[model samples]
Target chain A: MPPKPQNLKNPIIWFFASLIVLWAAPLFLPTFYVYLITEILIVSLFAVSTNVLLGFTGLLSFGQVAFFGSSAYAVSLLIKGTSLPFAASFFISVGMSALAALIIGLFCMRLRGFYFAILTLAFSQIFFVVVYKWTSLTGGDDGIVGIPKKPFLFFNINGPDAYYHFVLLVVMVSLALLYLIIRSPLGEVLQAIRDNSERTEFLGLQVRNYRLASFVIAGTFGGVAGALFAPFQGIVTPELLHWSHSAEPLMISLLGGMYFFFGPIAGAVIFVFIKEWITGFTEYWMFWYGLLLMLLIMYLPGGIMGFVSEHLKRGKDDSR
Target chain B: MEFSYFIYQLIIGLSYSMLLFLIASGLTIIFGLLNIPNFAHGALYMLGAYFTYFFLHSLPGVSFGIALVLAVVSVGLIGAFLEYVPLRKIYERSHALQLLMTFSFILILDDATKYFAGTDFLSIAIPKLMDGSITLPGDREMPVYSIFIIACGLVVAYLLWLGLYKTRLGKLVQAGTANKEMLSALGINVPRLFTLVFILGSVLAGLGGGLAGPLKAVSVGMGETVIITIFAIVIVGGVGSLKGAFIASILVGELNTFGVVFFPSFAMAFTYILVIVVLLTKPEGLFRTK
Candidate 1:
């Protein structure tokens, strides 16, 4: 009998396999490694959510931080101020993001390309300014501090290890949901719009409505990540709302392979490690990082996953 | 507010508007031709201020005018290098890539500046020629530098208008902005024109920075603080319209000034609100050029 090829190409199997490994990872790893992985997972979720718009829908937004930051702030405030359950606070924060996205998307969807990017940026800056100047409500630049990691649905997820497990499970479920979303018909329609909105509109689909849907979807998931981030960090700041901070996920998406579903995960791993490694040695890390980004944009626009997939295809072609 | 105070604030707002116009005009012109949003334009403006300060301090007995000229020229050279190098490779790429590429320049330039300039807020002195304030009828005082800035803005606007509309090169620029392929097909050197336009834009940004040094804090983060406001002006005016940038700059500058006085808490939000309002009403901008 001929040798059977490996089934590594199947993402579900890979997903479950990675989940098993990651779920067991904290058992062998130190508390620091566990915390680091938690951070990476949060960033990966954020990047993947952003990719839904940039990669799947072909929209380059500069205001995604608004959703993420607002949710972070909301979750933090609710945890600190009210007696609501963690789950309720989480849901409310994400819901607020969705509502915010809908309203902003309504205005922004009318514009395209550069105009869209600028309008979204303008809106996000409004959020930033509000967060920065609303000292009584937001604590202004000092940000909200000392946020407790309260119990969630009878689970004591307060310590670093417990929180890591909670984050891992939540991120995995979110990733799975996002994966299913991208694999569904809505995802196909979004991609179709990305490739050619005029053709999609010719098919009788309302392009603007679809874009708004994508925008809200991105914002909702971004809110989830933000909600996760607040408890993980034990604090939240207005810096989260800044437009410059919005670039992190976009850079991660681009670095990971915006086209691939698992690309940002790969990117998040590399990005976190690289940032850690670089910042360890030099304060001039931004200069080096900028240089890397420039080179990537210039020569490696397809990113790491794109490069890997292309080489794999070439190998298959050569064997054929 | 008292009438004299209102006039005083109005003049101050006009000076700020002129400075903003100088920066936005360059950005609009560069965008008009090169079709790339130069995120590093603000960085260049920062460099202009830094270089002017360096020139003034390093070269003893050097007048501020001499320092300003030298600083602008240096900025123009850097702009040329930027255009000839990384920016040149991305003309055929997507706007996302172009934006990222330009954004990288900001990171590089800002960090490089911090490495050399040491993260301090450096200030430049107003030239002796325009250092004092004039008293108005109601005992309100306005800085002479404010009047100088307003004059500089009007002169530059007039000169830019003349160059853009009255000169042959300006006509070529306008033609190129309208249709690059046609201009290139006509045997005009489009690449050279692009380089020239980019340099011109950079010089304007540099001049704005140098001129603003005496009025505002010159620091590493100054580029970032101004870039968003500059972008709002450009978009509000119309991406490629000089007149649009001018009008939008004035509107934003005055709104910010008055907002600060009447509604301090809402001041920061005013420019963004104006942007949202304009984009919602007229997606292309108020004075959209072709």
Candidate 2:
């Protein structure tokens, strides 16, 4: 019998190969396609942030957009209104989002399960209301427009290719950091907490603290994504802070199957492409989208990553 | 606001609470008996309202009372069909899957309404009997429909109490809630019981929506707006507990009414604030046990 391919034994190598493909795709794809890839990258980072809590710690947050929206608004305002450079505004945007997450996480991370989900949702709504009502600060429903793209250090990052590369670099760094966190001992503890929080607590782990740490980390990444997203989209609106926006990450995580490290990234790609395609056909996109979600949940609960892993396992068994 | 206006607001708030109570009580009972949190309850409510609108429109001179009865029954049957087909298979699965399935129903129902009813607000004409306004002692006039809604809520609440605490079916439902495995072990048909509970819940939601049709804009996305608020009330009241649902409904209703009066700009955020405060104080909710 033929020996099994070396790639079958190692999934990480496949992931790297996929990364190379993603990096090189922009070079060959059209400008419009490159913009779409940038969106996929940003959304992937957002999904990864959410997966940290959902897949690792069994926490489902419905207010993840609060961080994302707040950061976007903050960065957009700073870049548009002040004379601050792009680098400074970007850092400030991330810092503001992280700070907001820390404060909200302190109060929210105390609750468990459904209550936690509701709490986060409530907080996000509060953020939305504040942004919507505070016309002076957030520009109300019209949204903050005319946000100029910042130069990448000395180089102009305004062009589609330059913006794409900058976003690619940020996403790559974020994913690498996330991968490291997931492989560490801390990640094992988080998995244990998800499986059985009570047992983990009995084993002398600070479950609440660990969960909070994870929450803050997730929020920071989410905030970073939002900060990048504002410049990429060239506007920041209260809609970004809406509960529906939060659902995007949740749907992607579920679509990708949270159990796998790269599930959310794959889910983001499929989700964006499907959304783009479906919206082109009809205005009742939500109806079809809802149907798709139901199908995914019922038939492919493990998501695309789960599908791939199962296929690989089946192949191995067949060869044996 | 004047004292009379305050009284009027209170009445309106209580009447709104009545509709909320009917829908939420059904949800609470189903959650109690079947251990399934039906996320589609709001969608069912929206369907009920839309059906009432169409029925009233198609049949001129039909009394609001008869239209409401037809709406409730039709919605109840639809709810039963939903349970018999999809929900029945997932009863033994995880709550996560159950949530996903019902959540899917929201999309299907919302789009179906948009397709059939069109994406616009529809209103039912108030019946002739409820057209007149009653004069208060302070020379204030109030709509008779509001009073009618309050009476309906009280009657439904009393009937529900009797049904749950007094009837044999209620006892069986309570027993099922306590231990479904044990109830089934005793040879009770749990699946049929679940279907009954779901139908009954859907009927109540339909009734609420039918009643609310006159008071609020009967539109396609109405369910989406109210579902989150209803979920907050259920959570605040403690899931699966009728008494908790009742108290929380009133609490939320009053808060919303008063919050608007006091802080007009921040009124939308008030319900969420109440939810956060309630969760922080009692993580299991105000009345949840274990």
Candidate 3:
């Protein structure tokens, strides 16, 4: 991977600056587009959580959706069944997802490559089965709907505009923390494990423990995203827990660059738009989906963001 | 509860295991031989079921056996073309890329199948020869088709063994799988061998699909559904090991049938539980050939 550009005057400045633009985007654009952007934010969070495992930890997990869906269900159920406040339920749901992650990661951290991927997939399916069949608790296909929106601080979050802003606040804070972690020493160690596990192990570091920690953290973030999604959509179905649903972030991660921090965000934005555009023409979107994947893998391995960065780097080299 | 009931479940389980083994053996062996995880195997199986039904409907008077044979063979030919055309390009890529490439085929093939077959439950006709039920040693009546499927499993096992251990092409295949570069250097057409092995695997999957149509409802996404179980089977057995796949298939098949009878709701989860237990105990698999 090419070195990330440090051309900006200040990244924090650029971040908040772009966020301000995004904050104003809803005002000018149609109300429907604001709703779509909220969906994009949720998806980005999901994809970024996945990147914590894939890019940082070097584990290509196909089961992160297990955590994602479970968190969503937990929050939804808590709201419907109990009087737990939004913050309390969301925190509890996040922790719940992390605990599930810890158990799965305990078993999965031992395996490498395909073994890890397959094991995680099996674990995910177990959750899906439980949520689907345990109709009494999960409501199965009916799911838990009509989840009323709770107030965020002093502001009411009943409308789409308020919900969109609330989602932005939560996601932006979570992403900032995520960026900080990726820049930390533990983050460096995770990358080291990904690059060369044996060398890291030789340094007397416990590889499996680190993997478990990364897994838990990622799963917790995934949970937060899911928790937000449940109420945003006003329902939590078994479909959320399905393996295909898990593939969304995976596909987005592949579409955006894995190595780059914002790759998944870009991927998610493009993904939602493409689906909207393509579904307009044909119901059989799988062919086009496959073709796009093929083209990405064949020509632009780094994904759209990856390709753009590669081109930018080439331009720099030519100038130099 | 009764001895006869036990016998019946056992036979049913065995017959079901035979179906899984037919599909999984091909799936597992292909990974060993070609080092390619043919993700579209389930799609091919679905096609087999659909094609056999198509052939039967078109002919109107054709024997079920003949239609099944023709369908399996035709799917095999399609597999050959798939390998020669697109897959041959990506044989040397990373595992992730290889998986994505083959998975793409699932997307295309499944949609095409729906477009052609019109997504409905199609019942497979049980031919006259194997339509009757026979009494077992316990005086329990069993479907002759179940017995026929078991026989098919036995024949496939024997043929697989015979071909692998007793035939020249089999030796070439084994040699090719073991060391493709060395085999190529020895003036052997390694690419052709790879294509042949892929086709063979496709045929076995097709057979499984063709045979399974009579026993189960053929519907859309059957390919995706079965493929996950097949993955669990291979994972439990250990990928690239035919013997492991065989044993795992039997274990899973039994669990699948019995799990349904006992805990109908949790039946599907058994495969994953089995896989987790087996992996926790023995990471490679129960019988790790490697």
Candidate 4:
């Protein structure tokens, strides 16, 4: 049973159609759903950003929160401490994340596999410690409270609906940009590195530089997500920077299907909803969640998108 | 700083270092042979403490020594199950999957412990026999339990070195660590050996946890805290090098002790700083037995 050639037309249309629906969703939905969708959008962006490293570049970093949490804190500080506008704060925080990624990635690029993972975890833990112990500056464990949703440029994104719309716009644009990166020539080299870095190097590519580029891209967008998250949540805490929190984006990327561009988006949707539903019933949701993740890894290592695409292919074959 | 005060801190740091070596030795052993960095290794350590607490409380008149042994054995059995079940399926998978699988174990084990032990920090009392302290010169006093921990670490290190170098099975383990395929081609039951090594590793973690119980507040999050430090020791020492783990543990322990004295505000960042520096300078570690 040879596989049939796939059609790309339907997916492109579906992508745009879904975007339109998402763009207009807050208007028809209730306030609660508006908040949930905003959360999903932010999480999806973060997961997608992380997947650039994990799935695309074949690097598993456990320190992404260094970028995300730092950006969140930076944005929160800028918005509260200074009279800077929201847009200025957002770009500054994201730029800060890119700089951090460059510095960290320079050192981290030398290692591969488990060493890379551990080194990243250690570096991120440094962020966690600094954030946790710098009590006078970061408020320590008490965290920064009452971070208001400042106006983005002319629009007053102070209310839930306005903020939801603002997040939706930013996330959609970010996702579009990430999609472009994944489809670019640089993206091709990254995927080549993912499949076989040694072979790609023999083809005369600078593997370390490409890896650093991917790391910076991921960190910048992760910062984008974090910047948006600070105003949305109205608070920031050191826990956001902890190594454990770094697992969330990676898990989301794995859950959705790492290979696909939209896998993490699907994962974020399901993850947020499942988490909300589970936490509603039991305080010990992590037990069930861990059990679910274990089962998924054992049986469905391909994740939701992989499973769905496989079934769709099977269905096409059967019809043929 | 006073010379006596520095010596007291040195001794205190040595005790912490020895306890770290106990847990890290198990982690390095499992990693050496099994090639799986067991993220749940810390959770197993936590379980050891919890199980010791459980046995000591539930059975009236059981001594701490007996309870610690029982806890270690129980943890070993759990380790066996882990090796046989979920872990067995992922031996040939990518490092990402292996790490995620082991990480899942941490979540399951930690949550299960939280459900059983409650979230409050629980303290285990020092045994009546080792409860007292010895006063040194300059009026510095050190707990007998800390001294016991240091002694236990030295004894275990010697025994592990002997077992690894002196015994036939130990030679096979060393061979397997260097080349698993050749060992498998030569008709060794690699899987069974992996299970045995995993059990051995778990027992060591459990012992470390049980020993650490009297010193620190035993809580669900204790594993998460120590696991990172243990990882730093393993990486700095070079993974699977027992001698490296021992020296690195001492380095980390002493650096931390002195770091607090010299740079109190930045004390928490010292170990991570060491990790970054070591990783940057020598990613393979200070010692590479493999």
Report chain A TM-scores, every model: 0.96, 0.93, 0.95, 0.96
Q: List lDDT for all candidates, in order.
A: 0.90, 0.84, 0.85, 0.91
Candidate 4 local Cα displacement, residue B129, angstroms: 0.7
When 1 and 3 are scored with TM-score, the better candidate is: 1
List, residue by residue over B43-91, the lDDT tens digit for candidate 1.
9999999999999999999999999999999999999999988888889
Superior by DockQ: candidate 1 or candidate 3:
1
Model 1 residue B196 lDDT score: 95
For candidate 3, give the lDDT of residue A188.
81
Worst 10 residues of 2 chain A by lDDT: A1-10
* Top-TM-score candidate index: 4
- Name model 1 segments beyond 4 Å from true: A1-9
Predicted candidate 3 versus true structure: per-residue lDDT over A1-320, tens digit per residue = 33442333576986798779888888899988998999999999999999888877778777888999999999998888998778788889999999999988988888876667767878999999999999999998888889888875578888998899889988998888888788788888888897789999999999989989899988989999999999899988888887757667877887887777788999999888887888889777776877787667667767888788778879999999
Q: List the residue pairs that clash in candidate 1.
A: none
lDDT of 3 at B209: 93
> What is the DockQ ranking, best to worst?
1, 4, 3, 2
Superposition error at B50 for model 3 (Å): 1.8
The DockQ scores of all candidates, in the order shown, are 0.79, 0.59, 0.60, 0.75
Model 4 misplaced regions, further than 4 Å: A1-15
TM-score of chain A of 3: 0.95
What's the TM for model 1? 0.97
